[model samples]
Target: MPGSPAQAPAEPSAAVRSAAAAAWWTRWWVRVLAIFVASRVVTTVILLIFAANQGQNPWTGPKPDYFSFATIWDGLWYNIIAVSGYPSTLPTDGGHVTENAWAFMPVYPGVVNAVMFVTRLSWAPASVLVSVACGAGAALVFHRLLRRVGLSESTALFAIVLFCVAPVSPLFQVSYAESLGILLLAVALLLLVERRYGWLFPVTLVMAFTRPSGLAFALALGLHVIYRWVRRGTDPFPVRERVLSVSLTVFSGLAGLAWPAIAGLVTGSWTAYTDTELAWRAAYIGYVHLVPFAPWFQGAQWWSTVMLGIPGWVGIVALVVIVALYAVLLFSPPVRRLGPDLLFWVIAYSVYLFAVFFPQSSTFRLLLPLFPLLGVLALPRSRVYRVLMVVLFLAMQVGWIAICWGVAGADWSPP
Candidate 1:
């Protein structure tokens, strides 16, 4: 009697069913979210401990309260833009540019304002909410991108941990545009990897308005298109598809220039954005020069004139070492391992940074966009190596937060 098809098995009881439902948390995204939350907790604790040790009461503030510490510096500017829209005319001091909202991009603040409108929350909380949510999305997209690029799941997840704990990662949690910019950049690149060029247009457009780093993405996509064209003898796409791809690439590159153009149009000056950026240079370095490596020469000359001692020589030597390290990294195996699109993007981005921007403590924050390159660390399969790197990353996070954000007064670093 029992041998007749075995009764096709009975349904599990309610307790067993509930247990199975709970087990659904074992999915990959669930794990990713868990790691993200845990990492944020660790970072927050570190920030709290350091702020306390520095005798700073994070709870009370004239500006950046405890809940709003992440919204300091440029983030404060974003808040202003969110609360009060950008002024039509730039503030100028005797024909020289002064601090203005034009320097900060709009997307981050726009989202914050929208959040405020919808939730009726204050600017600080709304800004932080936008950042945290975008940061979480970026983490998930980054993990997926790494896996899509052929890394094993373990390697991809490790890269995510490394990224979330990296020294500059606090920026991701802040009210700055880095979180939104990174999210857009990751999405654009992921779409490119999937060969969905048309979708890249809008994403890159939004990215352009988010950060100047959007130019890096546009260049990356353009280079990728050219790479494909060069290999056209074995080309996979038909003529129509190829034309569409090239059109998208060109459109994306143009979109990267749109924000600056808009700023120019708004201010009735072609050099509005550049002039505003140069104001900082004028204050710090006397005059702004358009020539490449001008900042390096100017920095060297200024250092030599000011220090006039072993400290001067040490500064020059340190500068040389940093430049040399960047050169080495340009061709390093680890950097090359970032694959063609990323390799080109990093190279173009680094060239732009070095050529146009002066090096400072905030340069580290600028390098946050290069988080994709951290995938190189995942190449090592050794447990000891991974453990050591994790330790180093966590330590650097503490150091960066303390030195750059805590100890250094405003204007020492842009953070």
Candidate 2:
């Protein structure tokens, strides 16, 4: 009996437990974390440099002691609304600017104001809190998505870092809608992974209401679901799922349109922003023709004034690159084994971004949800495919940073 049934060893000791926890930090993920931190620091430096070069603005400028500068143009107005709720509009052309119509969607500012009321924190600290919390949420979203895609913990950490600290990701770390938008986006992605299409609507509705960018995302996801169903010749979703998904997506689309629509009504018209655009959006149509191709414009223009923009040639190259790469990513082997389930969200995201072509909206920001779409192209099994992925990874990080500090989100004008 003694020879046949020796007892198993006891549980790990307290010291061993501590040692194992310490060892966990030494995993491959630790390297990824280190690289991510380095990337963030570099991006932060770039933001400071950009702020320093801005000459001066009495309202907003670099910190006096070089503490660090963050927040972009739209961030200021969002902060204003947070500090003091939207002032009663006095009527400009349509509704009054004081109505906060031009500031941004209400959700982020509402949070800012709520925090001020409850915690009695100032705008500066509150803004920082918004940014940090949202940034962490975005990181978690990427981590979950990467895990869903079967990436190792280390690679997932790298991607999460890119999403969190990379230059393009500053929006997540500021008082802007980017961070909140990211959290909802992550929740939506997780729901999608769980096949919880029912959540897509409410989540997307909140997202759409929170940020106009969310509308674009909602539309993209909606179309993707519809397209898959159409392709299958049978309803790709169960009857209840189909009804709920479509209904929610429809609601989201309308919710995005509602604020503008209501703003129009309040102003005794239905297109205040469009009117604002008409006064300044002359070349917008011509610009859309450049879509799915290259952005030929040198700098994005507002009020007939142009600023530096992404090279049209670069846009052309990036377009080709997006297509050629995603082509391979779309039909890879291991992923192919997972079939439609694997690509559902990616396809949805791509369709959403593709659904819009205008310059007035944040279609590019919508691309954040499409990160996985971009990752799809990197899914193949090959040396060349793998190398291309490395290049793409580095390029995305650099490109994001350029957009944040260098390109200046190109679309937004400072409040």
Candidate 3:
């Protein structure tokens, strides 16, 4: 029998075949695409419903077309940059604030311009195309990151769904830098975690050009080096890896400043970028103050001077309480389940926002970069909990779109 041709392996059992099929369907990439598609479909449906309810046809309404809706606020500024270019001289009115194209980053507008050239479409349509495509890419990368951090396939998919339904997620479909910035950041982080040091440089560099959050990536890279060295002991990484890591940290930091440097060079003024930004801020605070928590103190003082003194003070207290609650959540059981790298980026980004950015109605949109951290919600397996979370996200998305983007216009907040 041994001398004879070995008999062919027996056919697998039906149960084994079924399990193999199931496993294939549950593969990480497969789940990621499925979740992304399903989420996008849901978002599209919600947008359509809202548009119809507003008596604005997606095709004919003057300001009701989806492209116009998506291309409002910052999108409009980006469009102007796409059609024209940055102004040679900053414009002002009555020695006060007016439009300054320099306040907007160039990546989104650049992409829109390229798209227009290729397709012969106008800026608005091109902007939507770039944003939606980048948004999809960001979702896929984010899902992959969740899995890399040890989530089960089901959990990772759920997290992607949550990200799509986030309150400010509409911004992802608009002509904004958030989608491209997040996609680049996710790529940089994934490369760093996988120890693909050579690839992190360009990815992080592009992220820097995409948004101010690029500086946060540099900080995250530095923190990553320290974390590895401390956790794994000295000389844990090979010499090449160590060199590449240090190079990326330094180069990405510089790249984050490249845009402002370019602006200054073009204008022949070192403070061109900051001056333009402060001009926009003048309407709110009238000046720039970098001291920590200055805004909170200023808000309290301003409230005291206003008619609703007690209520204003109470509002300031409420804001502090809310921030404290978020801090507590960062250390909660579910969030602790994330890997150290993920945790570090989330904390570093939040710190940057608090230290440098104003707290405004647009805060949620600004937080879109942190959406990946919401994957912690997937840690809980309770069906009721999952259902409740989805319901809450959907309700908040509807409310935000209705109040912030729908009725309020530019008077309330910049979408």
Candidate 4:
């Protein structure tokens, strides 16, 4: 036996190699990156398919390329802002304020302009790149947020999967500010869950400017303060934290209103921003004053009467029932798993939307901010359920793009 040649080390079997690959795929960052890339590929294809069918519209000629197609809708407004800053003299039609760049925030286009300055990339590429990068960042931060909220790693990853394939996920790779806003929100919520109040100041400031979320966040902070105070016996809301939280809430509220104030100061018109916003809804309900918690009811009535040919009161009653159902959902066991911080944010944001937003096609896009609820959907560990939901979400992405992103004749749907 000693004289016999020693056998060389055996190679790993196919099964062993397969298992090793599986293990590598299970690593969190690897999985996240893989999912993000794959989702982008899928979304890109869907967008290309739709872009092929595109007709001559306000945004592009027939069958425009991907970048041209992507930069349509709100992207065109952002493009205008990036190139030419908002007009100091508000544009009016027939002595009534018209929809203009004031309705679009500055931070997103500003960032895109900066990117173009540094990288020498054109508007479409640079804007889409920023959005895609922010979206990827959002997905990573979202996983951590889910973990912080006490979900398991697998469940958290599943939530990311659902997020990447959601109906509005096309916003991630387009020229929309949603990706940046979502990235900020995921980080902000993670900070809130960690009780990092001081850091939230800067995050809240940027978030407020990036999108219309500051006031809602402030409302959430206020609610969070009250909740902690009520549960202080067990939660122990310290005086330092209490003072800081209170200050942050006030700051956020001011930040929320800061844009409108800036718009007014710049245009020499006190109602510049609100007027511009109201103009978009004018096509449906005509010019109206900004009334808190009244727009949704108005929207319901208008939509019911105009579209469905039904009584307006029926729409109002239906809205009430929907609100009631949502309130019930907030207390559901799955939503409660997200903890008080996220739950409060959801409630406050929903209220803010109800108060300000007119229920329309854009309603789904506005609901993108409530993405934390995806965690609830991800809670079920059944493999079949997760697969089916992912399939459904992908299908919805197709429908959403066709309806909202593609411009038909006199298209009313906006993503």
> Which structure among the candidates has the greatest TM-score?
4
Q: Using TM-score as the measure, name the better of candidate 2 and candidate 4.
A: 4
Regarding lDDT, does 1 or 4 come out ahead? 4
Error of 1 at 306 (Å): 4.2
Error of 3 at 355 (Å): 0.9
Q: Per-residue lDDT for 89-141 in model 3, tens only?
A: 66767664355888888877888788889999987788877877887888888
Candidate 3: Cα lDDT at 271: 65
lDDT of 1: 0.77
TM-score per candidate, in order?
Answer: 0.88, 0.68, 0.86, 0.94
Poorly placed runs, candidate 1 (over 4 Å):
1-26, 53-65, 300-328, 331-334, 407-411
Cα displacement (angstroms), candidate 3, residue 237, comes to 2.5
lDDT per residue (tens digit) for residues 11-48 in model 1: 89999998888888766688788888898989888876
Best by lDDT: 4
Arranged by lDDT, best first: 4, 1, 3, 2
- Give the per-residue lDDT digits (tens) of candidate 2, residues 323-354: 67876776676445333543655555555444
Error of 3 at 299 (Å): 4.6
Per-model CA lDDT versus the true structure: 0.77, 0.56, 0.75, 0.94
- In terms of lDDT, model 4 sits at 0.94
Q: In order, how many clashes per candidate?
A: 0, 2, 0, 0
Give the backbone clash total of model 1: 0
| Model 2 TM | 0.68
